[model samples]
Target: MEQRESGGMKILFTGGSSFTGYWFCRQLLEKGHEVIGLLTQKRENYEGIRKERVERLSCEMELIEESPFGSEKMIDLLKKGTFDVLCHHGAYLKDYKSEQFDWLYALETNTKNIKQVIHLAKEQGLGAIILTGSIFEQNEGIGNVPLRAFSPYGLSKGLTFEVFRYYAQLYNIPLGKFVIPNPFGMLEEKRFTFYLISQWKRGNIPAVQTPHYVRDNIPCDLLAGCYGRFVEKVFVQKGPFYRSNPSCFVESQGAFALRLSREVSKRSALSCPVELKEQKSYAEPLVRVNAEPAIFEVQEWSEERFWDDYVAYALEHY
Candidate 1:
């Protein structure tokens, strides 16, 4: 296993049972870092854990895989232990469209769980908190973009970012929000990947609106590398606002985060420079190839205001 010679660090990931979560854990473990995983078993259909696979990938690192988001017992178990890092990667995205969107289940789950973890981190004064942010949470210009269709998911991510921001401000803790575009590759769920493979497996791939329009279509390997960097550099840093994609760290002593694209036409005390590499692709049009938008907005506003803008923009354009 390869890691910083300094020694091993204990890390906790809220969602680590499957897909990207599984690989994230694997990478951390490979780096000789200890990982305490929290798996929510709400999805009974896929209830069993692949212990064999986990044991194989875990290698030299310690892994305590269990559900720590549900009841008092679970929370107590989490609180009792200590972790150098606490990452909230656990999210419920069972289906693209569902009636449960009205309930705002993801927001409710993420907010409550993240609050608990943050409180615990504050109490322990752990490293930093890393929350996953999707590109969908961002605005897509003036129309009904495909990303805009992710209303419920976007709302949850927006709320989660706010919650982390508020807590970071109140407690004066180090924090980072990894706002990723579309990250795909290894440990990729066959079901989902198969769906895409099937689509492209056949014939002409229609290019939706050209891929260059998107922001950062990062690969999982690159994403894992980014995560490792965050865990090392930005985790213990002071202040807030660190974007993994464009690479900006807004420390407490620095300026706030504003909207910016690959090209910086406008400047503000709030904006920071971050280089983003673009990719090339011919339209196989399975799922908007290499689409990474240039503009990325960091910082926060009220949910009401966000919803208003989102709805108005979506209605007019979508």
Candidate 2:
């Protein structure tokens, strides 16, 4: 366990049970920051991967379970506790991928009591605020024309940032936007990587849709390291707003799947053969990725540890 000798800021964080949230908070803790995690659901309510995430986070830092963002419990904590940074990371996820996804509903929930949160941070002399952004958001990162959000859920995230940034600007608070691309590693949701491993477990080859879409995928711990470094630097910069779009493995989906398969082959007994389906659907952008490419190289010791942990988790859980 390593720790920073000085500048260990106290941070109020939400969404600790989320995949990236868990890694980001852990990185901060490893660097000696005090993290007070605010979990949206009661401890008992989380099941499956989310449950395991929460349990791991609980043993590491201060956690106020069932304390959703904008809830009375969170408001009370802000009023009573003096924090150096406020990190809002939670979001609504039901039907997030569908065209029927309600961005307005998510917008309302995401921004509820945002003004008060900013106000409290201002009064408490909080050094800065960090809000997680998605590259899928319209006009975010580098991408094809418009950079239109991949789905309604992405639009909601973009709007959510606007609402938070608006209030933070009003108070002249320093705000840091840490834009997330596709982060995959241990304790992640049952997404593309999970699907691949689970199919292998069933002795079936997995097919990748939207194989030609140029996207960004990075190890979660590496992304978390970026977040930790960004926070440490955000306070000193003279700014009303700052942002970092961390990118890694920026390539076509088919190429990325091949990279993943090769990596799995090196570390596990599974050959992990994958097929790339002819991409017919193009609802999302063909090129959408983070603005900052390779904040940390993919060849670090942490990246190796990432695969070790990831493959083990996949084999045991899938």
Worst 10 residues of 1 by lDDT: 249-258
Per-residue lDDT for 164-277 in model 2, tens only?
A: 888888998888999999999888888998898898877889999889999899888889888888887776574789998888889998998998888787888888899999
Off by over 4 Å in 1: 1-6, 42-74, 98-100, 113-116, 139-149, 190-193, 199-216, 246-318
CA lDDT for candidate 2: 0.85
Deviation in Å, model 1, residue 259 alpha carbon = 30
Candidate 2: misplaced stretches above 4 Å? 1-6, 296-302
Best by lDDT: 2
Say what the RMSD of model 2 is: 2.8
- Residues 1-318, candidate 1: write the lDDT tens digits: 122355777777766655556766766776677777665543333433444335544464444444645446456755787667667777656553454564266666676655665676678657667777665563421223443424566666777677777987676667787666554444344432223223332432312223233233333544565566566565556456665543222111111111211111122111223222233542222222222222232222232343344333322322
For model 2, where is the 10-residue window of minimal lDDT?
A: 294-303
